[model samples]
Target: MLSSTPLRWPGQARASVAMAFDLDGPTGAAMLDGSLWGKPEYFTFGGYGPYRALPRLLDMLEAHRTPATFFVPAWVVETWPRQCQAIVERGHEVAYHGYQHESFFTLTLAQQRAVMERSAAIFKRHLGLVASGFRTPSGDWHADTPALLLDCGVTYSSSMRGDDRPYFIDAGDASRRLVEIPGRWELDDYASLAYTRAPDYPAGLDRIASYDQTLDNWCREFDGTYREGLCMTTLLHPKISGKPGRIGVLEEFLVHMHSHADVWFATCNDIARFWAQEYADD
Candidate 1:
């Protein structure tokens, strides 16, 4: 059975839904190096040997004239500072990812705070703009997540999974400095191919229908609550979404979003700032 449905995005205002491309390039390299942290490490799910897919992804975004936010690791900035700086200079946004790409959930509260503080300082020092957003290394955030993020003064974090809409995640605390923006869930290509054993992974373009269905799902969710002005986010890792063959799938989706009125293509910072002003209530 085939079902056709309209696609709606967060805030589905006549305004627009933002398209975010997370540039996770060089750090993928560090992860490839087996990382100083240890084994069972993940550089990429598709296997990361000699296939530098990220540059191609960047080229694709450039071709689309699509601006993105590169949530970069501090180590990457320390190593490839010029490239990180270049991203911002060329109009893309830069946000703090992590210093060592370590999972926040693995760290103690003190360790997490130090990680945030050090990474924020490095991002500001190297790039001139303090990272306004934070993404956990593996989408793994720990129990004290809300307090840690708030204490560090981060504006919004894209690590949560319940919904795609952006919302003021009240930590139910005094330092409520954080907002939780929803991100792609098991929907990521890697999760499907490896974790879920989805057959589409090997079929490539044949999986377009599944991709389309995902987008359709987003639309239905957004349209249902258009008046609520929700925050929606999609996740992309260069290794996963950057394949020459797969990038087009994403590109097609971008075109689809633009063709429809009311979808906004924006940076993470832009979306968060807008949400703060128009969507959030004190």
Candidate 2:
């Protein structure tokens, strides 16, 4: 049988909230397949994230005084250097996603290492960022992914859906482990908000959910997680949640979170560091 232990957050806070965004931009399999060669429309759709939505989202986060984490693909960072820098300038964190949202499950150990190395170098060159955190771009990882990430100097990840609290994944070494700040599908905006007409993408255009219900669901999840004193991290996407029509959903959710007392709003890096330090023995 399994048991649950509530984590005591910093400052005796009831719960911890890490607002994370997967800044994927326009890089994906489309780039690999040559299908996105002339689709300015597709490019525009994804470009909306860094070009327009990011500024609004940044301002909104500033208004709430909340720190966030952006898991960016290296390609996106290279393409939108200024916007990516703005995230750091606004007191947020920039973590690694992948080179071009590649699936680690498809890459060999060597390929994975190369990807991390190239991505890390790109981040360093473009933004002077040494990313300590990672979120798997494809929502899954290779069997040896954890070890490779540690080798690349990544200390934590905001992937996986195993638990609501932070845990450690064995990094193939007894002396060190990578911290995992897990997220859930219920907390991801892509699952509820993204829509595409492409037949190959999502198979249909039925992805969008009711905004009011989605907001309610987010609040309810927060309430339950807060009640249990567990960590809550969102798998949000700027392209999905930053739309003018949907930004209010994020705002209302933030307002609801602020209404509760003793809730710690932090970046994923801070939460992971705290967990790793406070629960070093675990």
Candidate 3:
């Protein structure tokens, strides 16, 4: 049996594209145990996202009149309220990532629930925003994740790679289901750009792949998804893609996309709500 019923996206567009950012900031790097906070280079590296890349990204998106989703860690939101606020002010969807980019596998179920509650509370109280969508920090989850998110009032999750289109998970409750937006490793920035000595992280490519090569890969995915009338969401990291050279690659892809009139640029929340209503079984 299928996890979710396959359905077309809203507006009859050729394909839907959700340009999402994981605004991790320094939270992931700094919050880790035994982090070199004394040297602070890692923290600075993540901080570059909001301090420099965010403004550039906002300008680029605004100039193109596109709305996007930003999955932010709670620590980042609390540390950089102004930047997080700017995202809300600019009319983008701010969704839950995690408290400090913590992997769900590392936490107990009760711990996971606490993380969700705290992040949601911070988003509401500090940013005046309530998020209905969630993307796990590590794109991995325990079996209970769907039901847990549903309990937290989350409507959609973008962490799974089960399909090219949106689907639903039963969440073990026949009455409630969670929408899965589906993300691919090939479409994520860390797949191409992240380099680390940390034992916990994956190794980057042999060398940073050229911008042209990466763009080609992304465009090819977009082209195929557009032809199939499916959803294609590109997961970007500000610290990685927000750089001068890499940002151009994204800009070029957007320019290419602008030529197509049939594409729908949407937020994950918008897509999830549409799917829930369109595919809901009575």
Candidate 4:
């Protein structure tokens, strides 16, 4: 059930919207490929995101003049410097996804720490960004995940679905709370759009959703979010939503959203900072 309580959006907007992308690229697939590293069959499937889909998606954002956040794996940033550079150059926010797309549940606390440290270093070295936001690759949240993000200076997390609007997690510390910008599977493209010969957990539906239906659902969700003055955070992947047809649907949604004069389109970090300043205890 969605919340009916209102939220205080920035700039007196009726509601807020965040367009975020998980640019996992080949890192995740390769990591999942185990010993078969560099095998084009599964590896190249992810490669398509950086090589083919990214530019198209970027151009679409540019055309819409919309600011977005791209959560990318450290390995992807390291592997495709130019594409990563392009993302930075375009004035979009780059936040941590992980070293690879490995789930925190599969790793020990120590392993998670190492991954964050290495990924943070990559963010600094390559993009000169000390990232303050994180989205887990698999949306896998362990008991220690919040504290781990806090230790890494990640003030905001976009992986949890505890609420329909932004809220704070205890962070295992009485004094400090972590801001959570919730995301739902209904707003993600992976389940409906992504497919593979050998299926994984989210095997992805056998058939891709038609463009009209996708746009309809997205707009319907946004309409409710706007009516209740809550935050709507959508999760997308370049590999899935960057298809020409899907991109068209996204553009249509943007157009419909833009028609509403009171909508505030912003990055996830911007929303988190706003909440910290406005809603956090002094």
Candidate 5:
């Protein structure tokens, strides 16, 4: 039954997980001091606060020869088009992170569609890539988002916080274009940030989990997916993962990934395109 999943790569391809970065700049750090979901200082300060470690991050990833996808907000791209271009120029995939970084759950359906359209336009005109993927700001999406995303020409959305495996979403009639690449709540940097501990090293908690017990769950899911032929994904934020102190945990995890040969470390777009081609009739 598992091997029946057309999404699964051929052979023993253990779940090929893509590493991603939200790439919100220092402006988000400043916003931390402001009101966010009734919490002040939410993302206002930290390792990712916009000192622009992209160069360092690039160096680090280069050291490992790793390719990643960067989900960039339209405002961030407008703020740093050069940097955004550099990300593409350096070979990492770019996906939409909304226009304003506002949660879709908070917006009216029209507002959500407006933002989605704006985001797609920005990516296409500026980065010269037609971003077929979407990730909600704060990972919040209403049930109506899929329909609106289809209306906006989005082929897949990555805000799902459940199983790691990707699956086709029946958009009913609004649009059959949308697919779901399940995101994990346990593995995202945001989860670790909110995960309370006395020590409260929000950054370390996520990095630590990447290599520690948290990863066990990811592997279990990966093994299950590969054995049964499923799919999976992991999400990261540059503010958290790109930091020097925390990058070690991510580095360790990548090294661990290297041990597995069958896994396909591919871009989110690659997954979406392949699925559409292979299962369009299904």
Candidate 6:
């Protein structure tokens, strides 16, 4: 469902789309718990994201002539500087995920600030990036996270699932607000695609949705959002969708989306800035 208020897109566009990828390379629970320290297999499994999958995805985006945003952890940038650099070189926005994909809700205010500060510095030093966007590492944030993001110069977040369009999040003061370009779990690749044995993510070992079915669902989602004149932001992961077999699903979905008329494919930063300027009173 969408908000009752009308949302006007730039130019003659009917709806907006933001293709987002989380480049979580060897940085997650496994890395934090030291489980992936000596396990090269496990390490390389996640490593496949930046090492192999990213270049392919970049080329695919370039081929489609589409823009995207990559939410990356600072450690991934530090480990794979050239690969991460290529994301910017290819004309995609690089937003903050976390320092190590840590759970934002589990972190205190001070720890959260520390993570943003450390991450910002790493992005600056390595990629010359001053991130204007963020997606919470764990899909949630602490109470003080919004204000802290403003403090860190982040202008928007694609972490929550409050609405089908762009909205503003007040950071205690009405004068200062952050644009929220919400995304749904249904749009996230990991919910249906990611599979791991040791960590057993999704836990029960029963995961990985059918490619055709997933593509159908993604297209249907785009159709619904487009019909309602809302925004669609995906929670895609390079490690999940960038696999050989699964990349076709993404390609087909993109093709399906591009087939539509007056649909704007934009980066999260552009969407947020437009929302902030257009709906400042809302």
How does each model score on lDDT?
A: 0.62, 0.89, 0.85, 0.85, 0.66, 0.92
lDDT of 3 at 166: 83
Determine which window of 10 residues in candidate 4 has minimal summed lDDT: 196-205
Q: Which candidate is the best by TM-score?
A: 6
Model 5, position 50: C-alpha lDDT score: 32
lDDT of 5 by residue, 1-282 (tens): 333444546454655666777776533323434433343334433224334566667767777777777778887787678778888888888888877577678789988888877877788788898877787767777777787787777788787765556667767663465777767755565654333232243545533443455455545555665565455566777676566766666676677676677777777877777667766666
| lDDT tens digits, residue span 38-60, model 1 | 42334333233113554565566
- Estimate the TM-score of every prediction: 0.71, 0.96, 0.93, 0.94, 0.79, 0.97
What are the per-residue Cα lDDT tens digits for candidate 3 across 5-77? 3346666677788888999887764476656476467668779998899989998899888889999999888
Better of 2 and 6 by lDDT: 6
The lowest-lDDT stretch of 10 consecutive residues in candidate 1 is 192-201
Error of 1 at 197 (Å): 14
Error of 2 at 206 (Å): 2.3
Residues 1-282 of candidate 2 have per-residue lDDT tens digits of: 114566778888989999999888887877657777778777787888988899999999999999999999999999999999999999999999889888888889898898899999999998997999999987898768898899899999987988888888987776779999999999988778888764245556575789999999999999998888888999898888998989999999999999987999999999989988898886
Of the pair 1 and 6, which is ahead by TM-score? Answer: 6
lDDT of 3 at 32: 68
Q: Rank the candidates by TM-score, best first.
A: 6, 2, 4, 3, 5, 1
Pairs with backbone N, CA or C atoms under 3 Å apart (clashes), candidate 3? 4-168
Q: Itemize residue pairs with steric clashes in candidate 6.
A: none
List per-candidate RMSD values in Å. Answer: 6.9, 1.6, 2.4, 2.2, 4.5, 1.4
Alpha carbon lDDT of residue 103, candidate 4? 82
